[model samples]
Target: MTRSLIVIFTAIVLDAVGIGLIFPILPSLLKDITHAANVLPTIGAMTALYALMQFIFAPVLGALSDRLGRRPVLLISLAGAAVNYLFLAFAPNLTLLFIGRAIAGLTSANISVATAYITDISPEEKRARRFGLFNAMFGLGFIIGPVLGGVLGDHWLRLPFIAAAVLNGANLLLAVFILPESRPGSRETIDLAALNPLKPLRSVLEVKSLLPIVILFFIFSATGEAYGTCWALWGSDAFHWNGLSIGLSLGAFGVCQTFAQALLPGPAVKLLGERAAILVGVAGVSVALTVMAFAGQGWMIFAIMPVFTLGGIGVPALQSLATRQVDENSQGQFQGVLASAVSLASIVAPLGFSSLYFLFREEWPGAIWLSVVAVYALAVPLVLGLRPKAAERASTSRRRGAPENSSGDASGETADLTFRHPRA
Candidate 1:
């Protein structure tokens, strides 16, 4: 890996850690603020609010990066994250807490910018492996974040936010000193109208070829939300596992997923091609979910974890394939749109999955996994229907010959297609 990749991946880990730090303590913090035993509705609202903010701002920030450059947008977001954590640490009221979470979500939109940064620096052939590492770093952080948050929250409810602030501050300093611009900012005057968040979504809707890829991202992300929403409930109801047991099972899966994603995608893509690799990943997850749906013992869940982790391979392959659908100049915008799709799913899936889980909780909690498998089944026809790489390449080449941007705006100086890496 290059130094830039190391820096970017490290930033990703710290960002994930910072975000994860709040998860284990958020409900307790809410209870402390609201003095209410039932904070589930508040938690749900906060979660939805966060996702809504990301859905609104992700494309705006991504388009901004395309205009102003990745470095500045990233620096701003990191700094915002650091400040937001500090604010959350000191927030005394429910309103203030919600505000802090909104800011966190807004800053977290930098993920789109980060993905664009990676695309700027990575070659086509190396993208899948690098993206695998990208997901791995994030998974590793989530694993670390919850444990660390639990430990710190035991000492003080506010301590986790302080720790997250410090980590984000460190991340900011690292980027300020070490990270280089992956691509130069456009020199043209910024278009104020282009920054409308809904504009990107509408533009994507107009592109028939790109719509399936975006929907795929949404379906994949929605299925992922089922785990966070239903995993603990299913674990306890099905196997009578306590909190510690549930955490351990999740931690085990995280470790397996991190390693599998870090080491598997590139080779899988190489051996099976992107579409086939994605199908294999989907198949693996479906099989695991099927087993999990019928699993009679706690040990069975653990035994099938290896197969479960194979699901991590699909997103990286899909991400790599998505990059091929657009030219370099539009990468940031396109990635932002994809991120918005993901955020939209995050907003909708939790409510839907949690409702489904509640319906099945009394009778058969394990049925939740089958719901996820059914969701995965929705992607198969889409994956099979995806345009071949050759066709996508031809499409992108044709787009490159056009005088308009991806959004159909007149191609101006900002449409400079040249990509420049400041350093290796």
Candidate 2:
């Protein structure tokens, strides 16, 4: 791999490691600090805070990277994460935990920048494959972080955060020394107007070709967020699980996700054949979620987590498909929009599912899942019907141009953007 790809991969691994290390430990830690009987609402509130931060700042950071370039933004984000981990490691109370998480959420757009960087350096034909590598790094981080966390938890609950901080600090040093500025020095001055979320939405809205994919992103994000929001609570109610069991269940999901991300992308693209892969992913998740809600025994619950993770089969494929829609310069912009959409879903899903939990906790404690399944079912048709030839052609034309500086903004545009399918 080229130095640029190495840097991008390093950034992604560190970011994922940070997230994976902390997430599994959060519920137990918060429970201890807050003395709350129902940790579900607390988790929901924390998730909502994280999502809201992402919703508000992701585009701004993406645009900032576009103007200022990917390297600086990445460094800043990583540095912020290191500090956040420190806060989490030493927090005296639950409020500090929330503060730490809120900071982490706002600054944890390293994947966004890395996606833009890959678009910066990769050719269109190889974009999907490169993204597969990105996903693989994420999988490795997921697998390693939790196992490491579990071992460390035996010593001290705060050990994971300390480890995460060390990893981020090391990454920051490596990045400062090795990563080059992927964006050109002659790029457009950062435009404050483009930083406004509405302008990007308007730009995307006017492009008829991108609307369906945008909708697909929104739905996909919402469903995924819903699953994350309710999974632990549902498992606890169903199996009388404590934090350790919940962590194990999530660890199982992470393990499956790791394997699937590593092994499935190539075959999935070939088996489901691109478009069909997206369709299958949405449908698969819906089925798995419905089954999970009804899962009765411990063994059954164990089986469902991995099966549910199988729904992730389409993520890299759908992102690759989306890449077929836009050109090189707009990849970051498009990606920024997609990330924003996911953040929006992140914003909505927890609150919505929390409402479901409150309403149906007595009657049907699993009601939150019904909404998740419904969202996926709705996405099936919307994504499948999209046959965007024009977008594909536009993307092809730009690939032929071979835009320079994979992570840099154009001469007149300031906002750096990355789409899941950053190839276009």
Candidate 3:
């Protein structure tokens, strides 16, 4: 990896670490703040508040990056995160906590910008592997962050946020020193109307060829985030696990995920190809969530993680496919659309899943997992149907003398045709 890649990888890790660091402790902290019989709903609302902010602001920041540059947006986000975590660390009431989380969410479009940075440097063909690398760093950070949060939080619940603040601070400083601007030409004037998060999504969804994958992304995002919103709480409720145990379990989950994301996608794509690999991944996610719903024992949960980890293949493949749908100049906007999709998921799913978990704690503790299974399963047939069409497109491109092993980028003549293709 180049120095820039390494720094960005670290940035990815830092972002995940900040998030994971809070997961093990946030529930209990929220419980203290609300003093309610059921804290799950309140926690869900808090998460939703954050996600709502993300949904509103992600496209705004993403468009700004397209106009200004990725570096400034990233740096501003890092600084905002550092401040937000500090605010969360000291928050005395739920209102302040909510405010802090909203601020954090507003600035959290950094990931989308970072992804655009990746697109700026990588060829389209290698993007899946590159995205996998980003996920690997994400998983690694999740491992370290949650473990430390759970362990340290056993003593002081506030410690994890402080740690997160420190990490973000460090990341900010490192980025200041090493991070390079990745946006190509600066837009002289950005369209204020173009910054609406919903508009870009509407446009992307209108593209007939992009519809299936976009739907797949939306469903998967909703289900995936719903699971995340409840994972720590579910363990605490179902297994009566403590913060330490929750951290360890999540850390171990991260380990399994990291291994899969770092190692599996490349080989899987090379063998089964990207489309098939995505099918395998989505199908595997459905199976894993189904199994997780039925896991009566905690150890059974551990046993199921590797199977769950296979779902990691879906994202890189999906991302790689999306990259081919747009011109290189619009990569930032494309990634912003993706982040907006995820942010939209984060907005609704947290509240929905958390409500289900809290409501059915006695009747069905694993209710949220069932929802997850259903969503992933729903996307499966759609994507499976998506395969033949993608294959046909590839076949057509090859017949037209598009490079089979060509450096899939936007500069060449073939790329211009790709940019102008009716489906594109």
TM-score against truth, every candidate: 0.92, 0.80, 0.85
Instruction: Give the runs in model 3 whose Cα sits over 4 Å from its true position.
Output: 27-41, 92-94, 154-156, 232-247, 355-368, 385-424
Candidate 2, TM-score vs. the true structure?
Answer: 0.80
The per-prediction CA RMSD against the true structure, in angstroms, equals: 5.8, 5.6, 3.8
Q: Encode model 1's per-residue lDDT on 1-424: one tens digit a residue.
A: 7777877887788777876777899888888899999998998899899999999999999999988899999999999999999999999899999999999899988889999999998866688899899999989998999988999999999998898889889888988998999989999888888788888777776666678889999999999899888999888889999999999999999999999999999998877878998999999999999999999999998999999888889999999888866667778888999999999999999999999999988988888989999999999999999965443443354567745333222323221121121111
Tell me the lDDT of model 3 at 183.
Answer: 69
lDDT of 3 at 310: 91
- Give lDDT tens digits, candidate 2, residues 168-196: 88878888998888875327776788788
Model 1 segments beyond 4 Å from truth?
391-424
* lDDT minimum window of 10 residues, candidate 2: 407-416
Give the top-scoring candidate (TM-score).
1
Full ranking by lDDT: 1, 3, 2
Worst 10 residues of 1 by lDDT: 415-424
Best by lDDT: 1
